[model samples]
Target: MKRNPRKVRWTKAFRKAAGKEMTIDSTIDFEKRRNVPVRYDRDLVQTTIKAMKRVGEIKARRERAFFKNRMAVSRETQRAHRRKIIEGVKAGVKLHEPMSVESPVSSKVQEKIKVTAKRHTALLPGEGRSMGMDID
Candidate 1:
């Protein structure tokens, strides 16, 4: 039996789309050989990709903040636990789950990111068209 070729991934499509110099009539064809056609207008794809990247970036920043929050909480808990141990307390250490404490600055930044992503994803609705000028 012969093995089939691997399908083109969306990441590759995104990369291709990113570098493409698109025009009004240009389009980004997704899985061109498949029967169930899925296509994107040039402007729409560009905008969507931009929004996706922005969201990813924002999420990355949030992840860093979450880690920082976790570490701070962990350190405080550790100090308390050590103090208890030094005081000759026989009670088992009470572990506290790290909760993300949202700072006002971080919250405001996240809100702005959400607003930007929303605006970018809200593309104008229009008639769909067949893949015309291929970007790939």
Candidate 2:
């Protein structure tokens, strides 16, 4: 009995869309064809293979931060801050100094954003339910 050759499958998308024509993806070495797909995150595969082959050693200090680096508080501190703001306003004091906190987001800014968002959420007079952008 005789068997025929099976067709190769392509499971990879283009690296970057460059006009119309053939795609440039030579991730797999097809000198002798295997049953795997052509290209899928080639750089990731290369790095993984290199890592697998090495007896890995520790590197420099990791700059990455864990989630616990930022502390989360509620109610008390928030209410105190709000009271301070209100007192500042009532005492004829102008809140002009720019509060520069990390990630361009301070508590005051967040409160303002929440207020604006609430105002926007409320339906205007005779306004339809759908008045937002269509992502599609």
Highest lDDT among the candidates is held by which one? 1
Residue by residue across 49-83, what tens digits does model 1's lDDT show?
88767766766676576568767988999999999
The deviation in Å at residue 45 for candidate 1 is 1.2
TM-scores vs. true structure, each candidate: 0.34, 0.16
Q: Provide the global lDDT of candidate 2 against the true structure.
A: 0.45
lDDT of 2 by residue, 5-104 (tens): 2222222232123212223323222223667775779898998677544422211111112112222334567788999999988799756878656666
Q: Which residue pairs show collisions in model 2?
A: none
The local distance difference test score of each candidate is 0.57, 0.45
- Residue pairs clashing in model 1 are none
**CA shift of 53, model 1, Å:** 1.1
Stretches of candidate 2 exceeding 4 Å from the true structure: 1-72, 93-136
Q: After the best TM-score superposition of candidate 2, give how far the Cα of residue 21 lies from its true spot, in angstroms.
A: 50
Error of 2 at 129 (Å): 36
Best by TM-score: 1
- Give me the runs in candidate 1 sitting further than 4 Å from their true place: 1-39, 89-136
